[model samples]
Target: MNNAETLDRRALRKAAPVVGITEPGYADHSVEAGILKSIGAEVRLLRWEGKRDKLLDMLPELDVIMIRDLPLLDREAIAALPAGAGIVRYGVGVDNIDLDAARQRGIPVANVPDYGADVEVADHAAALTLALVRRVVSRARQVDNLKWNIAQQEPIYRIAGSTLGLVGFGKIARAYLARMRAFGVDDVLVYDPYVSDDYLAQYHARPASFAEICGKAQIISLHAPATAETRHLVNADTLALMNKRTCLINTSRGGLVDTDALAAALKDDKIFGAALDVLEQEPIGENCPLRGLPNVILTDHTGWYSEASVRSIQEKAALAACEILTTGVPTHWVNRW
Candidate 1:
């Protein structure tokens, strides 16, 4: 090749395209740089917080971004970014990403549904179930205070031979059923009209109407997804069906259970206690009533996070992003094509 042609190619190589990653110093990721290089892309990871100065400087070279609760991808920010830059959300839910706006700009948004979280979530629900049935949280303090009480211990229930009702028959619900089988929970009732009865039977679970499940189970675990139809699946009316000593577990979306209704049910001892891994609003405000309630066991949504899960998440999430950016198709994506 001629020297002039070689110089032109060198210049083009030096001006490699940049891929933006908003979450700087990712916890368990190693694939980002290699993936970027393979596609003739330059990588830039940032912790930008809608800062005008910093964003303006980085905007020109960026052609793709990995969004992790970063700047809103609304019309304004979309207009502000360099033309032809697409976005990829890290996980299953894409509510944070502005899909309509991205679509309008010819920028595709992507999400990975690498759902290893199912088992962990079911385990979390079972943990809550054990905590509630044994009054683990409730009885611990009294013992610590050296006040041995009999009546406080009398209501403690046994999980063995008890009925476990699942409100939804998603992946998590199946995992929960798998685990509950070993717990001596012979009667597993599932409530999801979409799943065929024969399909559920393979999981060792029987189909039950929502009302029947609500009224019968000694332990209830919610595994429904967040949808327009299931905004408040467990409302006051359904909650009222639960016997006084029933235990409720919700590792599913917080909106699945009406918070106010749950608080009322807990206060009234309508259900013996509840074990919730989610709340109506995450990073739940300090003034939230459930936080103060003693009978309830509250965990800050850690059901989807674990050491191994984090590494898997980073790998799968990176793949999902790269897949969409290069191929314009999300392998684990949820929405329309």
Candidate 2:
């Protein structure tokens, strides 16, 4: 075995296990630190600060690595990890990680899929849908600028008796459906080929094609994953099927929608409005066409954030690390080879 692998095994046996975190936005790692400390592990925050080489250099020393969304752990980084070392994602979405490389290296990768953010994301989607349908943000802006009773300038639609469409009927989508149902949304249409018809019937939602949902539903919310089949599911052709009264809300993967098509639709008033918690490119590029659209509402992809959810994800990720260190397996293990 290499010196790094030898050192790691020795550290695991004699010294405290080393767990490193990369590019965390949290104020402190106290929660994760406490969890790892309880298992006799040392927590190190490798805030490489956009320095990829530095992070690569530190990977060899860690028995486990916990990461969020930033500073992607690509193949090179994964290959740098010593044998027996494992990686744990802070939350769902392992697209940023090079899973194939980790699997090839026999380095187990795990993620905390259920960190209790379903409610938060669903609430955010509902909020965005309401804001778009009611012209809430525009009205507030006009009211702040000394405009009175300007609601008539832009038509507002009542939430009751409207059709709700969901791109994916996962946990977040189900939670969003419940919230919309409370708002008097009776006719629900869902387009998820993976789910069975019985599953849709259980929730009182009708299974429909993507075109049908776009053409029929007044409010469409996206809760799909980012995959090759799902990318750009909302493209020009689909946007053409939407009516002027439609409102699109995406709290899921940004790649699910075609930004250019949506922007063009908004520019032409082809749809009512759109609210998004995610974008095709994060920190949204300056050249992005979606910016400066009055009818469009954008958030910093924070739909999965809440104090409780943050704490939950942190604790769960740390526990996964602990499991890797102690049992050589994680609760939500992914990339199994």
| Winning model by lDDT | 2
**Regions more than 4 Å wrong, model 1:** 1-17, 23-31, 48-62, 68-85, 98-101, 149-154
Tens-digit lDDT track for model 2 on 1-337? 3334533554556468789988755877899999999888999989787888888899998888988877688999988897668899887888788888887676888999899979899899988888888888888988999998875677888899999999999999999899998999999999999999998999999999999999999999999888999999999999999999999999988999999999999999999989999988987899999989998999999999999999999889999998888777688989875
Deviation in Å, model 2, residue 330 alpha carbon: 0.5
Candidate 1, residues 51-102, lDDT tens digits: the string is: 8557656655666677754455666676666544557776565655666666
Where does the lowest 10-residue lDDT sum fall in candidate 2?
1-10
Backbone clash total for model 2 is 0
**Alpha-carbon runs more than 4 Å astray in model 2:** 1-14
TM-score of each: 0.83, 0.94
